[model samples]
Target: MNGSEFARPIVGLTTYLQQAQTSVWDVHASFLPGVYIKGVTLAGGIATLLPPQPVDAEIAARVLDRLDGLIITGGKDVDPATYGHDPHPTTDEPARDRDAWEFALLAGALRRHLPVLGICRGAQLLNVALGGTLHQHLPDILGHTRHQQGNAVFSTSTVHTVEGSKLAGLIGETSDAQCYHHQAIDRLGDGLVVCARDTDGVIEAVEMPGHDFVLAVQWHPEETLDDLRLFAGLVEAARNHTTERVNLWPPPN
Candidate 1:
């Protein structure tokens, strides 16, 4: 089918804390737009935004039920306590509401086997949700340079080793991804396999074997939509998933 023929895949993004008057949780408009632009430019799908609050199981289920797939966007650091680690001296604890919201949404998506693409902090959230742990602080624990380079926003970094996994195929190689994070995964979660790592031995990508499409990356693919391949891969997966579901059960008459 042509790209437009497929339904626009709705993708949710987790928000961060903002100060409109007081501390209100919010996601940037560009966050979803960037992801959507990449998907449309590459695989011909659309994205719909979802808030990062009131993360009730029922609400999450409803949200996932409408979308063809989901994209968990990046944000602040996750609380180390969630992964059994003592709080890092340099760690910035993420908003508890944002964490709760994303966690609930992730749980709902997994239960339905919905295609998910998580970036940066979103990747860490996926890992923690699946029973994994995080390093809290890469420089302090892993003894690596600041991965969050300020000179170039969304710039590429050193190459990593792709372990013959789905992500390798998506990006075409274990080349340098757009690095922008200070944390890394420590203990892996249940059902997740480390797909890529950097020179410092940091877990850069994780995937679930036999899943519809549960891929999370430490890099920012949305920021690099010029490389439409990654977005194309995700949109294509969502399209195929939608087609399969329709074939299995036609819409109610």
Candidate 2:
């Protein structure tokens, strides 16, 4: 409700490319579940859907040029080849197209230092893109499957936030969170630090300190309507970015 939200930043959310099925339609499409758009819009920002691209760096830069904030929404497993690892039998098939497209997008966003909020698979993709490795199968390492509930639903986990971390004020020091992930970050990436975790020590959130706003979480805030700080935080950061951009290049008198 402060002045930071006055600008109503345009937040670009990336989508998936796959076969979609509805009662009257079944076809290949580039799309995201409506939850992402709902979350951004409810948080006092304009949401825009960004379809996947075909590994084009120039296009990625042009896309970031217009976006004040970026959201890499969840999707299929990331390609292990991205981080020099081989596929695991338990790992879901990699979506190479999405991986490359998002990687390029992340690269562009990072170069511009734009605010970025990543969720679920988006978190994993951010990690991999920044030179981190993945466990590929959490059940194998933890001997439990609580992190991933079967079929289209989120499981609950008591997650603890790191004190003084960027997410502490938003997600709290300890809170029950909705989660659904089979893989997790193994070795963290460059410029990223853990901000929270579940009881089992699985990394829950990460942030790139000293950046305007670059954060990722294993859970999806967009799925729950009660939380808006996460999205609002990005919006505020984007507003600051917009102000800086305008000052750097004033319009002609």
Candidate 3:
């Protein structure tokens, strides 16, 4: 392989494993929005789709062994039980398998210090994985459904980044985010600090301190297409990770 090809970081993106309808048949499928792949590629990383599957710490570690970074793409609501809560009446039915799979993958990534970027449901999952709780239904708390307009439509959110957060360094102080989530971060996760929030004070971004790179956002960066700062940041970190890995294993002269 050419130097450029070998240097390009391999980033694993989580996919939705669900019933899907296409061309001539409907079946349970593993799929992801093209925008997620576009974002990663446009930012100079090789996109690798990782569908939900039977996984444990060892399996997740093996998976991470081939990846330089991880992106937890948006999907179904995180099961409330994940964070020690009962399901809210409006909550989406549990995708326990996906939850378990992703939790394992994330644990492996964290252990490896791989860069991670979580979006929407992904952001919620990160919080839950780190011993945090979620609001479950924003409309009930905010008294409006502005964060999510329903029926697969995305709403615009003006999020202001925290002054000294890693996210602020990449996307500046403010960003017009494309959001489609009905739940928001409630209690802060362990070692996680809020990096951005909407006008309503709903947490929009969170990051784990002392990690190589672990940032998750409530908004959908892929949907915004115009802004790729978040994806670019992830790719840059992953590239650095790749460089470090190679240096640690020198090829014989």
Better-scoring candidate (TM-score), 1 or 3: 3
Off by over 4 Å in 2: 1-5, 251-253
RMSD to true structure for each model, in Å:
3.8, 2.3, 2.2
Per-residue lDDT of candidate 2, residues 1-253 (tens digit): 4454367888999998889998999999988889889888888889999887666988898888998999999889898888999999977787788888889999999989999999999899999989999999998999988888778888988889889888897767887778989999999999899998999999988999999899999988887778788988888888889777866675657
Against the true structure, what is each candidate's TM-score?
A: 0.85, 0.95, 0.96
lDDT by residue for model 3 (145-181), tens: 9999999988998999999899999999999999999
| Model 3, global lDDT | 0.92
Candidates sorted by lDDT, descending order? 3, 2, 1
TM-score: model 1 vs. ground truth: 0.85
- Range of the 10 consecutive residues with the lowest summed lDDT in candidate 2: 1-10
Q: Give candidate 2's root-mean-square deviation (CA, Å).
A: 2.3
Clashes of each: 0, 0, 0
Runs in model 3 with CA error above 4 Å?
1-6, 250-253
Candidate-wise lDDT, in order: 0.75, 0.88, 0.92
Task: Name the lDDT value of residue 215 in candidate 3.
Answer: 98
Candidate order, TM-score descending = 3, 2, 1
Cα shift from native, residue 10, model 3 (Å) = 0.4
